[model samples]
Target: MDRRRLTARALAELADVTVVSLSQIKTGKQVPQETTVQRIAGALDYPVAFFHGADVDTLPAAAVSFRSLSSVTQRERKAAIAAGGIAYLVADWLHSKYTLPSPKLIDAGAERDPATAARALRQAWGLGEKPISNLIKLLEAKGIRVFSLAENTKNVDAFSCWRNDEPYIFLNTFKTTERSRFDAAHELGHLILHKHGGSNQGPQAESEANSFASSFLMPRADVLSEMPRVQSLQQILRGKKRWGVSAAALTYRLHKIGLITDWQYRNFNIQLRTDYGSSEPDSMQRETSTLWKMVLDDLWDQKLTRADIATGLNIPHGELENLLFGLTAASDRPPLRNDRPALSVV
Candidate 1:
């Protein structure tokens, strides 16, 4: 509720509780009763079980790279942060159970030019000007944990952070496939170019992330070589599939790289606005978590379920569903309560 910027009085009113009671709950002076919990859950659109467990701390402001503050409300941002914390714990637990990919990125925060940083990372990753087929799969294989945001608010484009020496990226799956792809690269840029750069929320940081994303997705050499002599939106759309980017993104990149004139770029933008509105028309399949999927499948084979994972982590099943983002087939079914106590090696 604090992340939502809801005052105690307002939340109490919404939950049909007294402000003093809510204040007491906040201060840990009093535990919420069952009726209060149900009312609060209904008001917040969260599960009743979520209130039973203690809330987890979100990633620090400086540690996260939001695509834009203007895009999401404080409530949405805080919700994403809270979701990110759960993602981190889930990834951490999965890491212990399986041999996941390790981070292969080097810090490029000192690099002044974002494009240079993007190129350096491409070189480091051995991804020569070749178009990446699947951004999520590549990131997963490279040891960057990626998850889809379950909030469905559509305000958060995407955000990335590093916690406990591991990098995580969360994309708003509610957005277009093209937008989601760009968001993935944008967050990747943050992970590599802004490691430990905390709360990179200014125009400079956003510009850098955009540059990194542009170059990272559409390399200069490869994209330029294939560029059309005449400005053609259709041609670009056909080619965008090769780079797995959106028409608008390719148009901007072309203009940025001097492949197209400013007039042509503006004209293309106008056309995009008319044709696609705020979205692109494509049938690209939404990216799912490969690492988590594998882990869940293995657990299923072993008769261990998402419920088991949730119980082990002391997180609510609803919260776990948000983290898993339908990637886990077993998430739909109720998690079987494990009577065995969680194992701890001291």
Candidate 2:
């Protein structure tokens, strides 16, 4: 159900079984026969061995900090959470083989405002109010396991949560590069501000996260020094590349920091809506996971195909590729020589 995003009724239909029988099997009230099990596996496109693996723990809906919870459907939400579960398994496997960075995030639950919390984190990390060159790489450097949400729906933009001692972030790659970067920072806000204990969902939390992402991505001091006063939408469109954010995001940040007047803000927003509605013009290049790339390269050296990894984890090769920002699909290229030293995760 989790892997294929199928409901009981849907699975029953696919497997040619009655809903009552499927429900009974799911509840452990009745055991499925071998033929039924095979039919179910075939219907879901999962190997039968996948069912025999140890129970995989899924992220509870409550613990996840979804960016647009109000807009996401229940099935989309469930599928996203299930993706997190697969990510956890893959992360564990990577940890066993390599030493990833330790978590450097601070708990800012007590912070009065998201901007202050963002500043504290930046100072702690020695970022010094500069634009983040690569938000995905920075997150991985700080020991955040970043994964791509491969669901075809746009409703689930991004989500983040702490799994035991490790932090994980899932991003929807379907979005424009700039919006995706902001989503990454927004999830970082949830990880930092709501880590200890707080409502990481709902409008208030979403607003705080947006503020944190604004501050974290385009620091107030940096923006002031770079562009003290915004004049036109074209100027904003040009300057937005400096912070790797969309024109809309940069416009909001400028208004929030008083660099732009309310009148200007409203005008720019109207112009932006007119020009590019729900889309970014001249979008930045989408960010991919550096850590996963290095991992795959190392595995390629050992002649370990993505299929092998997926088989070991009891998941489909496509699912593994989906989680990895489609990095594994590149494995179809000519194999590399196994002459390099073992990869040391930095």
lDDT of 2: 0.88
- Native-to-model Cα distance after best TM-score fit, residue 119 in candidate 2, in Å: 0.7
Model 2, span 177-243: residue lDDT tens = 8989999999999998887757898888999999999999999999999998678888999889999
TM-score per candidate, chains pooled: 0.85, 0.95
Q: For every model in order, what is the number of clashing pairs?
A: 2, 0
Task: Output the worst ten-in-a-row residue range by lDDT, candidate 1.
Answer: 337-346
* Model 1, span 1-346: residue lDDT tens: 7434576778889999998888898789998889988998777765577677655657887677889778878778877887777776677677677766678887887455788988888899899899998888889888888887766777788998887778888888778778889999998877777775444667877888899999999999988789847457887788788898888888888888888998999998898899888777564677776666666655665687878887787666666766665765554343345522232221
The regions of model 1 sitting more than 4 angstroms off are 2-7, 10-17, 29-55, 196-199, 329-346
Error of 2 at 274 (Å): 2.3
Worst 10 residues of 2 by lDDT: 332-341
> Which stretches of model 2 miss by more than 4 angstroms?
334-342
